[model samples]
Target: MIINFSNLMFITLNIMSTLYMISANCWINCFLAMEINLFFFIPMIFSPNLFNMEMIMKYFIIQVTSSIMILLCILYYKNFIFNLILIILMNFCLLMKLGSVPFHYWYIEISNIISWKMFFMLSTWQKLGPMMILLYNFNEYIMIFSIIMNSTIGMLGGLNQISLKKIMSFSSINHLSWIIASSMISEIMMMIYIFTYTMMMFFIMMKFEQMNLINIFQLFFFKKKMMIMISFFIYFMSLGGLPPLMGFIPKWLTINKLMENKFILVSVILIMSSLINLYYYFKIVYYMNLNKNYKINFFIEYNFKFSFYLFNYLIMTNLSYLLIYMFYY
Candidate 1:
């Protein structure tokens, strides 16, 4: 992996943007940080290959429009009715940037064309600043709407997709719904959800990149590696929020919080959507395990580090019951 000057600049800008969001005292500064982040990300997306011109244009237009909307909201923060409208607009813009439901088409399109590294950033890190800002100025009605729509859309959108990237894109949206729901109850829970989600996505992205896989059919080529197959099973199933997995911990906590707050309908909707997601996740695992001829490849290197990290996460998740008990007791 060779790092170039532009890549270095991109990393610098990303850091600055994140720092600004963390330290921002006002909405103006947060908006500026997001702008800087978007400006730098565009170059990073295009620098790898110029053929991504169309995708780049789409990304730029969407981000710039969102930024402009956010700016208008900031400028009109005084008038009650006007401010409410602007705030709703601002929420919609941020949702667009986050690639949540109804605004996720552009993100899915772009994900198919970009490198897995860029996609990883887009799926995880890129969401941080926008999510933080949205959480800070949280709106219950808008958040509830986003939560239901995003979860439902994410579940249904991925059911027929052959592209791995597209599947993950919808999965990202599904997870966003949970993250937003958790944020409504507790910021700490939301942060925990983000951390766990990022780690899971990172592991899956690295595996996909390592195999140079882009679609479901490509997974068959690596059928000889039982380790890889098992890992994939664990990772994807965990992502679907199966019990006794790291992904389930945050979800379980979120449900508890929701129930405590009498948000029964939201909790039920979340669980139903998760079950829909689990169907696809299981389908992937079944496809991977359909064949049983194991061949050893000496040339292929394994990701021992990530595997160990994942194992640790599994152990920690199993112990989470005790942690919860201690907290409650």
Candidate 2:
């Protein structure tokens, strides 16, 4: 009971912090909200493992450094002549908070040491405060540079990674670029992208935890399970933003918005990078399907349990929401 109550408290505080950041009218308020968020979330991820200790410390140091920089920027944000420099400084600080490139090294490194649950928080909920604050003073040139670097680096970074955690970390960065792009067009689109991403990420992280998989090679063991492979295929494809999937909708809308706004170059880069991202996702799927020596049976066994159905239900829910979104707009 005590543990549950503590968790509930932390969760409530975390949500409140994000709300504060979103509703903040000034830079100081945003900074305070971010700090509250950072402090509240730290205790949730606490564990006895030595790696967790290392990861927590690293995370703490990075967040503090960014927070301090953000505070300093707010203090010196008076001169119009140095407005551009201040904008760059503030955006860089928030990007560091969001784990966007080129300040993404700490984000990727710490991902390898944390549990799936922690990583989920790191990639999804933890991003909301910083992202909302980033919009407070939007910088177009820096955003474009971030989009280009994040997409390209995320794709190339994931291609050579064997650890699922690191791959997802890079993928998270890639998705961050999309979120940033959506923010450039419409905050509503950014929220939509985030909602879909959080849903997909939760499901994927759950699947990984259920299977106890850390590396891509472990996926080979599930080759005989047709349902598992099919589900994984669906997840990866959606994540890669393939056509007719829920994930593709946001990207399509964002790219369309970009083109409508005359950001043709950004749209083109996003498309090409998405294709490359899909290549890696498909490569992983290919590994799941690879079995030359064994005669694979398509439906030897069906693990039609609650979790399996729940996963399907989640996918259907996303598609249903997409349908509604499309119908409305």
In candidate 1 the C-alpha lDDT for residue 37 amounts to 89
Which candidate achieves the best lDDT against the true structure?
2
TM-score computed on alpha carbons, candidate 1: 0.90
lDDT against the true structure, each candidate: 0.84, 0.84
Count clashes in each candidate, considering only residues at least 3 apart in sequence or on different chains.
Answer: 0, 0
Runs with alpha carbons beyond 4 Å of true place in candidate 1: 47-51, 79-81, 295-317, 320-329
Worst 10 residues of 1 by lDDT: 320-329
lDDT (0-100) at residue 321 of candidate 2?
Answer: 69
> TM-score of every model?
0.90, 0.90
Q: Indicate the residue-level lDDT of 22 in model 1.
A: 64
Output the lDDT of residue 152, model 1.
Answer: 94
What is the Cα root-mean-square deviation between model 1 and the actual structure? Answer: 3.3
lDDT by residue for model 2 (185-251), tens: 8778888899889988987888888887899887777535555666778888888888777788888
